[model samples]
Target: MFKILFQLLAISAAFVLTAPVNNSTTGISKLNSQQYNVVPFGHVDLDDYLSNSTTFANHTYLSAPGSQNGLERRGSVHACQGSFTKKLCITGSNAANLVGALCHSISVALEIQSGNHNCADTGVHSVSDQTQGTVYYKYKTTGKGCTTTAEPGTIEGALHKFIKEKNQDKICDFVCIRLTHGGNWSGYVGLGTSQDAVKYSRCDHEIGSWSACVNGDKGDR
Candidate 1:
């Protein structure tokens, strides 16, 4: 699991996309950002968390017929908990630790307070293209009440920074950006300088459109 996260996070020079500048505007909110206090990472019930059905409502598919780097995802979550167990093949205390990590990554991605969803709710729904070796993740987070403040180290905050730095929707791709060492229990708000590393991550959105990273604010379905 950790290895997979790193591979997804690393900025590769191989995959190239003819990402045209997508500066068109939408109904997304303003970029006024402030530190948001996010949920604290705590002991998680791996079995219970993995029990909730995850929503496949994230991942904006685009039609880049010939584009290599921006290949849109197809289909839905092929397999979940059963596949997850088989994919990792662990149990007991070891399984617990791994599940914790998985939950932590997804929670940070959506700034979800610990109990909102479960393992099945946050597990990896799909792997990347079989040929391209790209891993795609589908997630849902909300900025419904975020007037100025957002979840601590909010991916949305990361989104604001990403756009300011002229990022090309890559921050949403890195598994590492969405992950951290579990059991830290610290309530940090931002990714420290690692936020810059997030730019190296990849987000595959339509090149000419602007979508809110959050579902409530402007993430048009």
Candidate 2:
């Protein structure tokens, strides 16, 4: 009787400690995981790189099959949601000490469905690699360089966490880098639709659903 009582108390305590409060979720629907031959901007022509690039590097040009004549590493295509305004998502591994989570100066820009625009003077909307079936968790505060330029930082955090969790406690994939740089920064992460990418920001909402979303359906369903 004493042992049973102690076990019950321990379980109750565990529940109290682990229970979540005011649970909420956000994001878009995730695309099916598919292999993507990433053509790093470095490999593409200077003009093409500037137009369709997310990152800039001074590395050698290594060719990746299935990629345009200009590509280096082979990555995976994560998703492409929003009809009129779509996002071609991709992800892959990166060397440590390469990616940046540094949030310094930030700026915001919005492009309503219009013409072909270039963000060279500002920021580019490029994708990054993350673990399969993973999402980002943010913890932002003002006056910490994270406020003005929080989107990329938030993405970095999520990708890092997802990579760490997917590796099964392995350090081999401890880092994830981004493709975009300074000048063009957006500080939001919620739910985004092709029609309204700004307000619809969350990944789960963009991809599909989150377990916490009221209308979310577990995979089993």
Candidate 3:
């Protein structure tokens, strides 16, 4: 009886371990493999982030289609880029730590382009062909409620700084911006600059049309 029971347990364990992983049970396996692999956004290195698409809905602002630096994406729809990889992508912030460096670069770009000096509210801007008409604004720091003070200089400089600083450490394959719905609404405020890299690393769904992509007074989504 002992021998028979031991054999049965072994067989059960082996069966559980060898079973094929499917998307329905484990969210990790449901990634849209083809789109993430074939599309070219900022760099091919981003493929590592794309591989885990199951979690796309958690961090980013939007996932559009198109190529960056002359490489074309393979998708036709306007869905989030990598919602399937939430569990894996949380391992890294992708490019959150380089904000300081990018801020400095933006200061310089403002001087060169607009001939201004102060780096107060000099917000940055970023856009990929992925989102056909949308352009992203990367702000240095916002006012009391994620609002900008004034135009520091050229928006491009601010954005250039952000990209440069971000790329220095980890290329930004995914970005998350926050929004503040005031008046006692309960929701996540924002992730900190020094929090665990993957804790709150999922993209959001606050996308808008290209014509309405400019920053009004909203925080990161």
Candidate 4:
């Protein structure tokens, strides 16, 4: 369909605009739907945000939970054999936004086998919320700046069609966000770890399976 073609062109353009990372997805695997929790998310315009072009691909998410269509979301996890890797896979809408996808940026997801290492993302996913806490989604929009907890909503504020599936066929990680900022933008990937003295705020509000906490997921298998 025309829509699909446009998306392909866009993805291709994304690669052309930025230098490609390893993205060699050889060992990639995704958890089943029961492992990752559904989340709410929205389009965060990192318009000219970063100081350079960055892509958070080719990384493995070792600690995700089962996802559920809590906030009216959809999709499920499966075998990511055809994906960019060989691990369990995910495919769902947002049930808790940053609690689900963004966690990858802040060391929320652990690296396989390396029980001591939490995952880190260079993009917005987990960085924004992990750094700003659970309030960024609403606070940023309201100009309040993470003053309180995030209210219940859909992915992209429950608006729909904002958080597009970045990688699925070529990558097991179904969500991705690529950006080319020029330093003028003022956002940084939060380097927080789940093992910190503090919890992942309200990550306890599991929308599905993947533990919302930084050090939460421990493999249900």
Clashes of each: 12, 30, 28, 48
Q: Report RMSD (Å) for each prediction in the order shown.
A: 19.2, 20.5, 22.2, 20.1
lDDT of each: 0.24, 0.22, 0.25, 0.22
Instruction: Put down candidate 2 lDDT per residue, 38-104, tens digits, no spaces.
Output: 1111100111122223432323223331223433232111111112212422132332221222110
Worst 10 residues of 3 by lDDT: 212-221
The TM-scores of all predictions, comma-separated, are 0.20, 0.18, 0.20, 0.20
lDDT of 1 by residue, 41-81 (tens): 11101111112223333333222212223321221111110
Per-residue lDDT over 37-78 for candidate 4, one digit per residue giving the tens place of the 0 to 100 score:
332211222222122223222222333222222311111111
Judge candidate 4 at residue 8 and give its lDDT: 75
- Tens digits of per-residue lDDT for model 3 on 1-221? 99999997875542221112121333333334442332111211111122212221111222232222222222111112222122212112333323323333333333333233222433224322221221222322222433322232222222332233222322233333222222211111111121222122322223221210111110111
Position 90, candidate 4: lDDT: 25
Model 2 poorest ten-residue lDDT run: 212-221
Q: What's model 2's overall lDDT?
A: 0.22
| Model 2 residue 128 distance off true place after TM-score fit, in angstroms | 13
Score residue 109 of candidate 2 by CA lDDT.
Answer: 24
When summed lDDT is taken over every stretch of 10 residues in candidate 1, the lowest stretch is 77-86
